[model samples]
Target: MTDTRKSTQNAVGAPGRAADGLAARLVVERGAFRLDVTLTAAPGDVVALLGPNGAGKTTALRALAGLVPLAGGHLRLDGAELDRTPPESRPVGVVFQDYLLFPHLSALDNVAFGPRCHGASRAEARAQAAAWLERMGLAEHAAAKPRRLSGGQAQRVALARALATHPRLLLLDEPLAALDARTRLDVRAQLRRHLADFEAVAVLVTHDPLDAMVLADHLVVIEDGRVVQEGTPADIARHPRTDYIAHLVGLNLYRGQARGHAVQVDGGCVVTTTEDLTGPAFVAFAPGAVTLHRERPAGSSARNLWRCEVAGLQSHGDQIRADLTGELPLAADLTTVAAAELDLRPGATVWATVKAAQTHAYPA
Candidate 1:
């Protein structure tokens, strides 16, 4: 397994310079589950915690917010240790998944609440809140209550509220989850702009790959409470280290022993690849790379071919995704017309082929 801590630490700079940014090894134990992951980010960096449900993304966020107590390890921001700090006292801002705007308060008051709690006078808090609302383009909705505002407006109010206190660290838990698909697209673009203007470290938790890829400067992929991969969005998408990541990035991934350009994958299926690799290796190819036929193709030049059974089928946008089993269990994508021509359905046998040029192999 990769030493994600070392890699991340190196990416941000040396540990001795942790004072310049956010540095922490979060360790939290709950019943049988434990999360031990190292996270580091310089000022102005946006790090997204990308993981599946129950993968400890939320737990790590809570730990940073001082809501969840740490079993071991420390939390530090801008050189200050915050492990024992109370949630209310930490210089951190959190935007919950649900927005959590005070239903009774107007948007102005909701935004001013954070500054008030941080010891600003009513007038000063309101002044700061007003500026943040203006920055968020929600100044016209100052008097609107949470109940009267649209989902997008309410989310902006929540974000404005979090930013009023001038926090050194911002934590957003699925900031765009409440919006509709159309609203999400607009709000996501807006949020990306806002995050770019932020001068402090920001950490966001999300399961949406598109959101993470678009909004985060770096991605930390957590699985079963551990860091499985951490890198730029493009890097992780190009070279997924785990099955979850492979699926998340829309690729069919397999592990096996490599001999030159051939990989002996699971089920004794040998895959021919374009890269020359040896020893333990991983082979990955996009589902679209696979071509399916009712019978084996004769005089085909493709070096990688398998006899597979269609275990299931589902719509994926304009294309159909077929889950296959047998010689090599994998997912394949084909056009609706092609699928119809093949008479693809569960339990149907088919021959799948992929050119060696489509397969990528790398040392595991």
Candidate 2:
């Protein structure tokens, strides 16, 4: 309910702003794939659509950009209904997975294409294009063709072109995906800065948890073409609704019953919670929340503690991921230094505890 038009103009500033701006709620259908998503992105909000393959993530993005038809739902931007609007008619910019720059055109020319198509003179388009390239730190590459540019440079050129259009909404489909692992880290950092500077609503689709966690302020987790969960990165990381989401973020979640911020597990063990939900519910704790010990503490007042044996171990960052099998299976992450101190290894007996504050519960 803010003054969306004025907000759009101020957010994108001069370089990234089009005439007005965008908001979209699109429902699309095709063969066996159906996408029904509702999104309200502000001028500067970066909402990430995350899911596995075939989860209709790209389908929803396509619908919003007008590349795909809206079988249902309506898209609005700057107070205009765009569900039936042609892709070109909507004030939206899209950067595809691959930087689809024209091989024959110089970076500046490619960036100028949109302004030209919208009826700007060649000189005017080139003027605007030059400024955008300079803003992206690609001023030297303005005369370079697609093949002459590095992957990250090409990506910036593509982004410059997209923003040059002055779109109210920007859509990036796996923007950093084409880069290799090392390149990905570099580009991802650069992309984060670019996205932060973008004033309008920018939506990105990615299967990478790190990408979603790092780049997006809000995440919409899709599975089987439906939104299974939507929240901030911390919320999703701490309280995953489904096992798939849990595994993606490397957490463990269990559904059970809760009575006053406490949940009873299937094996008669009770776990404390941080939620107020009653009746059937879910209790989640992160792997880092579970501290492993070689022996149970004699005078510990911990609410939920278990003695288990390590079934597996894997390296996760600077820490060790210990997979334990006992009354109920659990995964715990501890520093490599801690593991070394405990002398923990596969088949080792360990004690795990869940601090009451760490256990989160909500209605299932």
Candidate 3:
């Protein structure tokens, strides 16, 4: 939490910044899926590639690590081009989602494998692995096999193994995805500290927003193999440009053209806001700002009201989220007690209203 979030302005250079980092334009082609992404990171920066499943997040990481061949584009690290380099030959290290520890090898040997492959002597590699294990707080589990170690312990060993080579680029694909929620929190904090201390470019791929926000200095959101948005966590969270991003940040978003206080959404209902906006604009509001009534309320001060039917309802923490469809389709958050009092259910008719002041309008 102490690490400052960096701006994602240029993927290549920044004013007064060092050049010893990663800069890559990756393009990969499969049967139908294509991933074309531009990525950059500073020496002490941690970048996170975040998106939904099958959104080319992992493909980007693979391209960076040389696991997947690039159809076109360049990859450079520390001012050296590495587009044609092999995975092992490149100064890159990878921690896969599954941990992928060697089943037959002990923890120490697993951590030492990379050093040994890089031409270090057996004794030297083991000694270096022991140091890494101790750093990861896993020295006691050095003799344990992959199956014998806990999930958290195995994850640390994998990280230690990847770092043993001291690569310039560190790539992690869902680093904490294999662990349970409780263990994930613990490991995530540890991983954040490790990544912060790493004096090289680190790129992590994850679909979890919390993980992306917590571990990285900048976030690159990809969808359908394209870079949809890139910025610091706060920037992206506050001003999401796409519906996917709006959903991720828990906002009801609509694109429209504004005239004075009225905005007519494309293919959706019109929204009225207190802010005076003109031309192309977007309207967004939190679910909690929406007020639902069983019957149309008379003399209500709210300017926007829609007659909708409950399409679906689900529990969200202590509140309930209602998906409504009609003049305006939106998700609204309601307290459990209020939901029960109204006997809210699918197909039920409800009048939803939002005060003009609650809706935020901004230029698209």
Estimate TM-scores for all models: 0.94, 0.86, 0.92
- Please give me the total number of clashing residue pairs in predicted model 1: 0
| Residue lDDT tens for model 1, 10-101 | 21122222336799999999999999999999877899999999999999999999999999998889989999999999989999999988
Clashes of each: 0, 1, 0
Task: Give the TM-score comparing model 2 with the true structure, all chains together.
Answer: 0.86
In model 1, residue pairs whose N, Cα or C atoms come closer than 3 Å (at least 3 residues apart or on different chains), thus clashing, are none
> CA lDDT of each candidate?
0.89, 0.84, 0.88
Q: Find the candidate with the highest lDDT and give its number.
A: 1
Better of 2 and 3 by TM-score: 3
lDDT by residue (201-295, candidate 2, tens digit) is 78899989999999898899988878999999998887788988989888778878888877887677677866777788878788898988898
Give every collision pair in model 2: 18-166
- Model 3, residue 4: what's the lDDT? 34
Ranking by lDDT: 1, 3, 2
Candidate 1's C-alpha runs over 4 A off are 1-19
Score residue 38 of candidate 1 by CA lDDT.
Answer: 94
Q: Return the TM-score for candidate 3, rounded to 2 decimals.
A: 0.92
Clashing pairs in 3: none
What lDDT score goes with residue 48 in model 1?
A: 96
